[model samples]
Target: MTTPVLFIHGLCLHASSWDPWIQLFRDAGYDPHAPGWPGDGATVEASRQHPDAIGDHGIDDVVEHFAGVIDRLPSPPILIGHSFGGMIAQKLLGQDRALAAIAIDAAQIKGVLPVPLSALRATLPVFRNPANLHRAVSLTAEQFRFAFANTVSEQESDELHERWTIPAPGKPLFEAATANFDPHSPAKVATDNQTRGPLLLIASGKDHTVPESVTRATLKQYRHSEAVTDLVTFPDRAHSLTIDSGWREVADTCLTWLKQQSL
Candidate 1:
């Protein structure tokens, strides 16, 4: 039987962002589903039109939303996530939920030190306004280009922005930034858990949002884990590695890894 796959999207993107990824995995014989964050609309148009629906939602809500989806599946699915979605994949794995997981240019979590300058710049729109913490935030095309598509051409970056970018909740950003200071913060992950399934962390060398350094530090935290944990770097890619024209390369790499795990 084909294994089930779940594609989790990042901040400022709707589930539709994974449409191509869903098709790729389906062609590879996997049953795939891309569920949006709580209150995120059912479609990109809906999400864009009703940004308020996703406002004020935090990371814990997102983790539980995906967890519920996993619970209802016939079997544990392969969890694949990007950016903030990658953080969700890690949280689920910490709970020993997925059969295997992939985190691509994942956002930083607690214990990750020395926040990257680019990452901070990328998140400035949200943190700049204190009131944004309780509201939905949208990014300008230029901001999106800088954070996600710097490695791609201007026209392609604009195309990516029109197709995938959308308003996202700002609460999660505040939560992640303050997680280390809060003992009960939901952004904390149990990296030492022995049962966390085989995990792969993919880093994009040119990514401005979640750089290689953050990914390496995240991997370091898992060094004590008994589970199989690996890291791979795509030197020419940016944060848009999973959505840009060269997404197939990232997908193929993941498919190869999944097959190696015999999932």
Candidate 2:
């Protein structure tokens, strides 16, 4: 049977952003699918037209949504997730729901203590207003440039923003921010699952939204687990490494790692 692969996108980018990955994974002898988060419309324009449908969902809600997707698969598939999607992949993998997972520039989960100034600034569009906690928030082109496309050229960044950007629920950001304080925070991941599948955490050195410091701290969270866990850093890449022109390099790196694990 062909191995299955699921691509999970992070906030502000439509699930369609995984289109290139889906095709690439398929060509690599895997069956790949990229499903939108709950409340996401069939298309980016549809989601934008009705922002209310994309608001109010929280971290746990997203985790559960993807878990349901996995339940219908022929078998537990490999997972590749970016940003908040990375966090969701970790949560599912801890539950022993996948064969393996790759989390690229994942958001900070509970117990990850370093919140850099850049990260704070990147998420300021949502945190600046308490009301945003329950609403859907959209990033302006400039905000997207700073937070995700900083390492890329201005023209390319603007084009990407127009192509993939969408309104994202603000609840996950709020939950992650207060996770350390909430003992039962939805942002918590089962990092101690020794029997869970192998996990690879990818970090981009110049990612303002999810700084390398955050990814390193996240790696520490898995130290108690004896399961296969590895970290790879792209020293000059930014948060857009997974979507920008450099995406193929990151994807190829992931493929190489999976082969190393004999997966």
Best of the candidates, lDDT = 2
Poorest 10 consecutive residues by lDDT, candidate 2: 20-29
TM-scores for all candidates?
Answer: 0.98, 0.99
Candidate 2 Cα outliers beyond 4 Å, as residue runs: none
lDDT string for model 2 (234-262, tens) is: 99999998889989999999999988988
Clashes of 1: 0
Clashing pairs for model 1 are none
* Deviation of model 1 at 257, angstroms: 0.6
- Cα lDDT for residue 182, candidate 2: 97
